[model samples]
Target: MSANANTTTLWRPTGPVELDLVRALDRRAWPPRLPDQPIFYPVLNEDYAIRIARDWNVKHSGAGFVTRFEVDTAFLARYPVRQVGGETILELWVPAQELDEFNAHIVGRIEVVHEFR
Candidate 1:
């Protein structure tokens, strides 16, 4: 396939999310950041996702999940990539109240790609 900068991208949760929130994402509804979470983070690769699910989320909450969704690549192109300890993570500087607009930019369905318990 040709490289398209505006194509759909795979994103994984930055941390273990509650099943309730997971369900919301599955319906293409991106939830607002929690009280202490100032930013909404989603990584660009599956490896990073797996590492988080296995190494962090599982340890914290005993469960983790991955979500596959499409955002307007053009919209995402405006943001800078944040490298956290060798991991290229995408940061959406979305405030809690703007989650609806965030979800509006997403194309198609948000799927649960993997789950760890």
Candidate 2:
């Protein structure tokens, strides 16, 4: 589906367990973060998502997936884009306690765009 002007696309690099939880949610929402996970970070670019999925998730979980989704641009404006590395390595850090609200802003189903094992 085409994203409207009010929407912004985001990508997430996830491990198999997280992917399964997403699937369980029927792709409509992300599950609550684990106790140790304080933030839910969705990346700003597909390439960076791919790198993390392949390099980190795969190494740690034996499988990795890149999921793409769109969220309301206005709602996302509250979180500043955080650049953890290079210019392209950008993401929005949504507080774990706010994930349900974040999920409410998602524009469409989260889709698995790439996978590595």
Candidate that would win on lDDT: 2
Cα-based lDDT for every prediction: 0.66, 0.96
lDDT tens digits, residue span 26-109, model 2: 999999999999999999999999999999999999999999999999999999999999989999999999999999999889
Clashing pairs in 1: none
Separately for all candidates shown, the number of backbone clashes (residues 3 or more apart, or on different chains) is 0, 0
What would the per-residue lDDT of candidate 1 be over residues 54-105, giving only the tens digit for each residue?
7777778888777677787776665567767674554445556666676788
Residue 8 CA error for candidate 1 (Å)?
Answer: 3.2
TM for candidate 2 is: 0.97
Model 2 ranges off by over 4 Å: none
RMSD score of candidate 2 (Å): 1.3
